[model samples]
Target: MEYFALTNAWLIPLMPAIAFVLIGLFFKRWSALSACIAVFASAVSFILAIFAAIAVIGSGISVDAPFVGHVIWAEAADLHFEMGMLIDPLSVMMLFVVSLVSLLVQIYSIGYMRGDKSFGRFFAYISLFSASMLGLNISANFLQMYIFWELVGLCSYLLIGFYYQRIAAREAAKKAFITTRIGDFGLLIGILLLQTVFGTVDFLELRQLLPSYIASYGTGTLTIIGILLFIGPIGKSGQFPLHVWLPDAMEGPAPVSALIHAATMVVAGVYLVARAYFLFASVPALLEFIAWLGAFTAFFGASIAISQREIKRILAYSTISQLGYMMLALGVGSLTASLFHLFTHAFFKALLFLCAGAVMHAMNDEADIFKMGGLRKKIPIVFITMTIGVLAISGVPPFAGFFSKDEILSAALSVNTPIYIIAVITAFMTAFYMARLLFVVFFGEKTNMRLHHISCFMQIPLVLLAVLSLVSGLGGYIYDFGYWIRFGAPQPEHMDISIAVLSAVLPLLAFILAWNIYVRKKWSADCIAARMGVLYTISFHKYYIDEFYAVLCRFFIDGIGRVMYFIDIYIIGGIINVISGLVLFSSTLLGKIQTGQTQRYAAAFLCGVIILLLCGILYFNKISGITAGGGVL
Candidate 1:
C-alpha cells in the first residue's frame, strides 16, 4: 500500500481525468452513466488519496524533503522542462481533502441536478475540475503547479458558465476569469524571475538553495518576488480588491460552488501561499503585510454577509470570510493552523453548501432566506445538517472550526496585537452573520411553495459531511494534525487556554445576540440597521466594490477594448480599403483598354508610338531655333 501510494500518486489525478474524457466523449448521451462514471472515478481517487495520507504517516514525510518524481518534457538550448509529482505531508493533506469533498459534491449533484438537460455535461466539467485540483495538489515544481492552477481556473470558467443560457452565469464566468488573470500575470512574471535568478523552478531545489540565494541577492529582490507571487493567491483566494468575483461565482450550480468554495479552486490560493512559505518567511515586512491584509479581508467578507438576503450568496460571503481566516493563519507564520482550518473547512463548508442545495431544492429554487421559515420540520435532515455546519463554521466548541480558528487567533495574538484585535472582531462578525442566516431561514413564519423531493443520494453526502464537521476538529488532538504539517521545526505545542476560551465564548455570544434579534424579537434588527445606515448599506452592497470595478472597466478595460476595436475597423481597415479602391479604379480603366483582341492591343501600342514621334519632332525644332541665334550652339 505504501509503495503504491508513493509511486502511483499520479494515478490519483488520472482517475478523474479519464472519467472526464469518458463522460465528455462517450457517456454524455447517457446522463445516468455519466453521473456514475464521475462519482465512481472520484470515489476511487478519494480512496487513493486516503492511502497517500497513510503513506505520508507511515513513511514519515517531512517538510524539508518531499518525495519527488520527474521526467523531462521539453528541452530548449540548455534548459529542460519537466513534469512530475511531489508528495509530502502538505500534498497528501490537500489530496485527501480535494478528493473527499469532490466525491461528496459529485454524489450530491446526482440528485440536485436530476432531469436537467445538461446534467451529463455538468458532471464532465466538475470531473475535469477535480482532476485539475488533484494534479495541482501533487505538482512537483512551480511550472507544474502553475499549469494545473490555470487549468483549475479554466475549469471554473466552464462550470461557472454551465448555465450559459443565463446572462448572470455568463457574466460571472467572464468576471472570475478576467479578474484572476490579473493576478496570474503577476504570478507568471514572478515564476519567470525565479527561473531567471535560480536557473530552475523546482520546489525541492528552491528549498535547498533559498537561504544562499537570500544571502547573495539581499532581501529586496526576494521581497518583490514574494509580493508578485502572493498577488496570485490574493486574487485566487478571494482576498480584498480582487475578491468581487468570488461571491458572484455562486451563479454556478450548487455542487460546483461546494467543490470550489470548499476544497478545490479558492483554496488553491491559500495552498500556494502555504506551499511557498520559505520565500515569505525570508521577508518579515511582507509577512506582516500578509497578516494584516488577511485580517482586513476576514472583516470585509463578514461585514458584507450580515445584510445578504440569498442563502447561497450569504454562504458565498462566508466562504470569502473563511478564506480570509486561512490567509490570516498563513500570514501569522503557522502553516499548520492555515492548513488545519483548510482541512476542517472542507467538510463543514461542503456540508453547508449541500444543505443550501437541499433547502433550495425544497423551496422550488427560491434562495432568499426571507422567503423561507419554519423549515426545520419540513426537511429535518437538511436542518440538522445545516445546524451542525453553522456550529462548526461559527467556531463553537468541539466542531471543526473551533480548534483551527483558535490556533489562527493564538498565532495572531502572539505576533501582532492589532491584527489579532481585528481577527477577534471578524470572528464575532462571522458568528453573528452565520447565526443570523441560520435563525432567519429556519425560524420565523413558515413559507409555502411547490416542494421538490430530496433524494437519498443528496441526503447521504450531507449526513456524512455533518459527521465530519462534527469530528474533524478532534483530529488536532487525536492525530495531532498540527505536528505533521508544520513548516519547520515544530513549535512548542500548547494551546493558549485564554485565547481558546475567548474565541469560543465570542461566537456563542454572537449566536445569542443573533437569536435575540432574529429569533426572540427582543431586539429590532431593522432599527439597528437604520441606526447604522451607511455602514449597513455599504456592507449590504458588498462595499460597492463590484460597482467600483464596473466604473473602472467602463473607463479603463472597456475603454481600451473600444480603442482597439476602432483601430481594427477604421484606421488599419481604412488603409486597406483605400488601396483596394485604387486597385479597383485601375483595373476598370485597364479593362477598358485591354480588350481580349489583338486589334485593340496593336492600336494602343501604335498610339503610344505616334505620340512619342510627335514629341521628338517638336524638341528638334526648338533646338534649331536656339542654335540660329548663336553659331557656337
Candidate 2:
C-alpha cells in the first residue's frame, strides 16, 4: 500500500493533465466528449486519492514520520534537487477535497456550460487547474510547490477569463493574475532566502534546519521569511489591500467560481501557510500580525458583502471573508481550526456558488439580487439548498459552518481579546449579509424575469455539496480533526460554552434582522442606509478599495510609467539624435573635402606638403641648433 501510494499517486495529477491535452487537441469539436474526458480524469484522480488516503491512514503515517519518497531530479556541486511525493495527513486531506470538488465542478459544468462556443477550452483549462492543485498539494518541497503554484495561477487566469468576448471577463482574468503575482513575488523572495541560508528547500530538511537558521541568524530572519511567505497567501486568499480582484472575478462561469474559490486557487494561500506553519510558529510577532491582518480582512470582506447586489459578487466577497476566517485561525496559532474551517468551507462555499450558478442559468445570467424575486416557488431545490448553504455559512447550529466557525472563534478568543471582538463582529456581519442576500433575492417583490429549467448535471453537485456542508464539520469533530490536521502540538478537546453560544446566537439574531428588513419590510433598508450615510455609501462602493488602488496606480505605477516614457522619448532619444547629428555633420565636412576629383585631391596634398616643408625648415632647424640635418628635419 505504501509503495502504491508512492508510485500511483503521480497518476492523480497526470490523468487530469492528460485530459487537458487531449481535450485541447482531439476533442475540441465535441463538447460532450471534452467534458467527459475532463470528468473522467478528475474521477480517476478522486478514486486514486481515496485509495492513497486509505493507505496513508492504514499505514499509520504520522505527521512527524510522513511517508515521503524522492528521486534525484538534478545535481550540481554541493547541491541536490529531487522530484518528490509526500503522503502526509495534510496532503492526503487536500487530495480528497481537491479531487472530489474538481470532479463535481466538471460534472456540474456539463450542464451549466452546455452549447457554449468555447466549451472544450473551458473543460481543458479547468482540468489543468485541478491537475496543478493536485500536484501542489502533494509536493514534498517548496520548489515543486512553487512550480504548481504558478500553474494554478495560470489556470485561474484562463478559467476566470473563459469568455474572452466579454471585456469584464478579460479584465478580471488579468486583474486576478497580476494581483496574485504581487504576493507571489514576496513568496519567491522568502523561498530564495530559505534556500540561500539553509541550502535546501525540502520541507522535511528545512524543518530540521530552521532551528539552526534561528540560532545563527536569530528570530528576525524567520520574521522576515514568515511575513514574506504570508504575503503570497494574502494575495491568493483575497485579504485586504490586495483583495480588489475577487469580486470582479464573477465574470467567469459559475463552475469556475466554485472551482477557484472553493477548492483551488484561493485555498492555495491558506494551505501554504498551514503547510509551512513551522516558519510562522517560530516567529510569534509575525503570527500576531497575521492574526490582526486576517481580522481586518474578515471585517472588510463581510462589510462589502452586505451591500453587494450581484449574486456571484456577494458570494465572491463572502469567500474572501471566509478565507480571512481561515487565515485568522492560522494567525491565532490553531492550524487544526483553520484547516477544519477550510474543509467545511469548501463544501458550503461551493454549494453556495453552484446554487448561484443555477439561479444565473434560470435567469439568463442576471446578477442583481434586487431583480430576482419570488424564486422560492419557481426553483424549489435551489431555494432550499441555497438556504442550507446560507445557514452553513452563517454558522447556524448543526450546520458544518457552525462547528468549524465556532472552533475558529474559540481559537481567537483564547489568544487575543481584541481580535476575538473583531471576529465576533465579522461573524455577525457575515450572517446578516448572507441572510439579506437570501431574502432580497428569493422573497422580495416579484420581477418580470423569465426562468429556464435547471438540468440534473448542475443539481447533482449541489445536492452532494449541500450534504457535505450539512455534516462535514460535525464529522470532522467526531473524528477528532485536531489529531491529524494540526501543528505545534496535538490539540485538546475545546469548546467554550460562552463562545459557542455567542457564535450560535449572534448569527440567528442577524438572520432575524435581515428577515425584518428584506423579507417582512418591518425595517427600512434605505432608511438605515440614509441614517448610516457615508458608512453605507463606502461599503456599497466596495469601500472604494478598488478606487484607492486606481489612485495609487495613477500616483505610483503611472507616475513611474510616465518617467520611463519621458526617458525613452526625450532623454534617450535626444542623446541618440545628438550623436547622429555629430556623425552626419562630420561626414558632410569629409564629403566636401572629397570633392570627387583627382585634381582637387592633388592640389590639397601639394598645399599640405608645402606647409609641412616650411614648418620643418623654420622650427625643425631652430630646434636642431647648429645643423639642419636631414635626419633632424
Candidate 3:
C-alpha cells in the first residue's frame, strides 16, 4: 500500500496538468464540460492527497526520515538533479489545503463566470495553477521547487489578467509579473550560490551539508544565501514593496483572486521559508530581518486596507497583512505557527473572496462597498457566509483565524515585543476595516439596482468554506499543530496566555470601534478624514508607493530609453551614414573616370602609361646603383 501510494503520488500534480491541457484545447467552446473536467481533476487530487496524508501518518515516519520518492531529472558534469515527492507532514498538509481550496474555487467559478466568453480559459488557468502549486508543495529539492515556482508565477499572470481585453487587467498582470521577477532574479542567484558552495539543492542533502558548508566557509555564505532565498518569498508572498502587485491583482475574476491570495501564490512564499527553515535558523541576523520585515509589512498593509473603498482591494490588502503575520512568525523561529496560520488563513480568505464575487455578481459587477448596501436582505446566504469570514479574519473567537493568528502574535510577543506591538495594532486595523466593510456593504439603505439570482454553484462553495472557517481552528486542539510542524526542527517556544488574550481582545475592540463609525454613523468618516487630513491621505494613497514605482518606471522608460534611442539614431547611425556617403562619393568619382567615351579612355590610358614609365625609371636607377656598387667591390 505504501509503495502504491508513493507511485501514484505523482498523479496529484499530473491530474490537474492534464486537465489544463484538455480544457484549453478540447473544451474551448464547452464551459460546463470544462468546469467539470477541472473540478473533477482537482477533486481527485484532493482525495489522493488525503490518502497520501493518511499513509504518511500511518507509516509513522519521523520528520528526520520522510518518505521521498525520486526520479532523476538531469545529470551532467558530476551533478545529479532529481525531481520527486517529499511526503512529509508539512507537504501533505499543504497538499490538502491547496487542493481543497482550489477545488472549491473552481466550483465557485462555475456560477461566478457563467456566460463569460472565456469561461473555459479561466478553468484552464485555474487547473494549471493548481498543478503548479501541488508540484511546489511536493518538490523534493530546491531545483524542482524553483521550476514549479516559476510555473506558479506564470499561472498567476495568466489568471490575474483573465480579462485581457481590459487595459487595467493587462496592466495589473504586467505589474504582477514584472514586480515578482525582481525577487526571482535574486532567488535564482541564491540558488546558484548554494549549488556552488554545497554542490546540491536537494532539501535532505542541504539538511546534511549546510552545516559543513557553514563551518568551513563561515556564516557569511549562509547569510548571503538566506537573504537571497528570502527575496523569492518576498516577491512570491507579497512582502513589503513587492506587495504592491497584490491589490491590483483584483482585476482578475474573484475566484482567481481567491486562488492567488488564499490557496496558491501568496502562501507559496511563506511555505518557501518554512520549507527552508534550516538555512534561516543558521543565520540569526537573517531571521531577525525576516521577523521585522514581516511586522512592518503587516502594519503597512493593514493601514492601507482600512482606507480602501473597493471591496476586493480591501481583501487584497488583508491577504498581504496576513501574509506578513506568517512571515513574522517564521522570523521569530515559529515555523509551526506560520504554517498553522497559513492553513487557517487559506479557508477564510477564500471564503471572503468568493463572498465578494457573489456580491459583485448580484450587483451587476459593482465592487465598491459604499455603493452596495442592504445586501443582507437580498443575498442572505452571502451575508451569513461573508460574516463568518469577516469574524474569522478579524480574529473573533472560535473561527479558524483566531487560533492561527493568535499563535503568530504569541510567537512575536515571546521573541520581540516591538513586533508584537506592531502585530497587535495591525490586528486591530484588520478588524476595523472588515467590520466597516461588512456594515457598509450589507446593512444600509437598499439600492434599487437590478440583482442577479444567486446560483447554487457559487452558494455551495461559500457554504463549504464558511463551515471550514468556523471549524478549521479546531485543528489547533485536535492535535498539536506546532508539534507536527516542528517534528524535525528545534522545538518552538510556547506562547504566554497573556499574549494570546491580548491578541484575541484587540481585534474585538477594533470591531466595536469600526461598528461605531461605519455602522452607527456616530461620527462621520468624512469628518474624521478632514480632521486627520495628511494621515488619511497617506493611508488612502497607500503611502505613495505606487506613485513612487510609477515615477521610477517612467524614468527608466523615458529618460534612459531616450538616451539609448539617441545613441542608436544619431551616434551609431550617423557613423554608418557617413561611411555610406563616402563610399558613394568615391564610387561617383570612379564612375566619372570610366565615362563611355573613346577620348576619355585614351586620356586615362595615357595617364596610366606616364605613371608606369616613372615607376620603371626609378626602379632601373636603383638597380643600376646596386649593380655599379657591387661591380666596383
Candidate 4:
C-alpha cells in the first residue's frame, strides 16, 4: 500500500507524458482521441495528487523517499548525477495545485479549442507541460530538477507559440525562450558550483551541507552565489528587468494563458526559491535585494496592468504582479506564506483566465475590453466566476486570495516597514485595475461586434475554479494544510486593521470610480487619454519598458549575433577550408610515394634509417649535460 503511494506519484505524471508522446507520434490517427485522453489523464492525475497530498499530510513526513528510483544520469570527478522522486510537504502541495489546475484547463480547452486544426497538438503540449511540471516538483536533486525545469520552459515556449503562423506569437515565444535561457544559464552555473563545493546534489544532503559550506565560503561568496541563483527566479517569475516576455505571451490561446501564464509555469520561480530556503537564509543581503526587487516588480506590474485595454494583456500583467507578491513573500523569509499565496493565486488566477477565455469564446474571440460590454447577462456563469476571481484577487474577505495575500503583506511588514508600505500600494493598485477591468468588460451597454455562447465544458471549469477561488483559503484553516503546516498553527500575526481596511476599501472605491467614468458616465478611455495628455501617453506606452528592451536587445544580442555569423561564414570557414586544402595536399604528396615498387620502397626505408641513426648519435653526443664517458663508460 505504501509502495502504491510512491507508484501513484510517478504514474500520475507518467500518464500525461505517455499521452503526449502517443498523440505527437500518431497525430493523424490519434488527433481526435488525444483531447479526451489528455483531459482524462490530467483529471486522474489531479485526483491522485490530491489523494497523495492528503496521505502525506496525514502521515506527516514520516516516509522520506530520498530516491524512489535512482539511475546514474551523468558522472564526473566529484560529480555524480542520478534521477529519482523526492516527495516532501512542499512538492506534494505543488503537485496537487498544478495537476488540479491543469485538469480544469484541459477540460475547458475541449470546448474552447474545438474546430481548431491543431487541437490535438494543443492538448498534447498541455499534457506534456503538466507532466514536466510534476516531474520538476518531485525531482530528487538539482540535476534532475534542472532537466524538468528546462522541459517545462520548452513546453511554455511551444504553447505560447501555438499559433506559429502569427508573427506576434512567434516573436513572443522567441523572447520568452531567450530571456528564460539567460536565467537558466545562471541556474546551471549555480548548480554546478554547488556540486563542486559540496560533493552531493541531493536536497536533504545539500540542506545540511550548505551551512558548513557557507561558513567556509564566507559572506561575500555566499551572497554572490545567492544572487546568481536568484537570477533564475527573476526570469521565470517575471520579476523586474526580465519581465518583458510575460505580457507578449498573451498571443497564445486563452486556455494556454490560463494554464501556463496564470497557473503553472510562472510560479516555478517561487518554488525554486522556497526549495532552496536554507541557502537563502544564510544570505540576508541577498534576501533583502530580492525583497526590494519583488516590491518594485509588484508596484510596476500593477501600474501597467491598470491601463491595458486588452483583456488578456491585463490578466498577463496581473499574473506578473501576483508573482511579485509571491516572490515578496519568499524574500521576507516567509516561505510558508509565499507558498500559501501561490496556492490561492493559482485557483483564482486560473479562474479569472478561464472566465476571460469564456468571454473571448462568447464574443467570437474578441479580447478587447473596450469592444466588450454587457456580457454579464449573456454569459452568466462566466460573469459569476469572474466576479469571484476578481474579488478573491482583490483580497476581499473570506476568499482564498485574501488570506494568503494578507499573510504576505503581514510578513513583508514584519521584515521591513517600507516594503510593507510599497506592497500595500501595489495591492491597492491590483484591486483598482482588476475592478476597472471587471467594470469595463462586464458592465455598460452592449458593444460587442460579434455574438456567441460559451459551452458547458468551458463554463464548468470556470464555476469550479471560481469555487476554489472563494473557498481554497479555508483549507489552510480547516485541514491544517498549506501555510498552516509551516506556521504550526494559524495565529493572528498582529493584524493592522487600518492597512487591511485600506487594502479592502480601495478596490470598491476603484470599482465605483470606474463605474462613474466608464459605465454610467460613458467616458471612454481614449477620451480620458485626450484629457490627461502625457499621463495617458506614459500609461498607454507602458512607460517605454518594451522599447527599452528592444533597443538593448538590438544593440547587444542581434548586433553581436550578426558579427558572429559573419565571422563564422567568412573568416572561420576560410581558415577551415585552407587547413583542409593543406591536409589534402600533404595526403596527396604522401600517397605518391606509396607506389607498388619494392626496390624504391626499400631504398627510401634504408635512407630514412641512416638519417635517424645519425641524428640520434649527434644529439646524444653534443646535447649531453652529464659526464657520461667518465661515470658510465
Better of 2 and 4 by TM-score: 2
Question: In candidate 1, what are the lDDT values of residues 458-565, reduced to their tens digit?
Answer: 999999999999999876646787778888886544678999899789989999999999999998999999999999899888888888877987899899999999
> For each candidate, what TM-score against the reference?
0.93, 0.95, 0.94, 0.87
Could you tell me the TM-score of candidate 3?
0.94
Over 369-423, each residue of candidate 4 has an lDDT whose tens digit, in order, gives 8888887887788888899999999988778877788788878888899999988
Residue 179's lDDT in candidate 4: 91
Q: What C-alpha lDDT do the candidate models reach, one value each? A: 0.90, 0.90, 0.90, 0.82
Model 4 clash pairs?
A: none
Worst 10-residue lDDT window for candidate 1 reads: 486-495
Best by TM-score: 2
Which ranges in model 2 have alpha carbons more than 4 Å from their true place? 76-80, 591-620, 626-633
lDDT of 3 at 546: 93
Question: How far in Å is the alpha carbon of 151 misplaced in model 1?
Answer: 1.8
Candidates 2 and 3: which is better by lDDT? Answer: 2
> Of 3 and 4, which scores higher on TM-score?
3
Q: Regarding TM-score, does 1 or 2 come out ahead?
A: 2
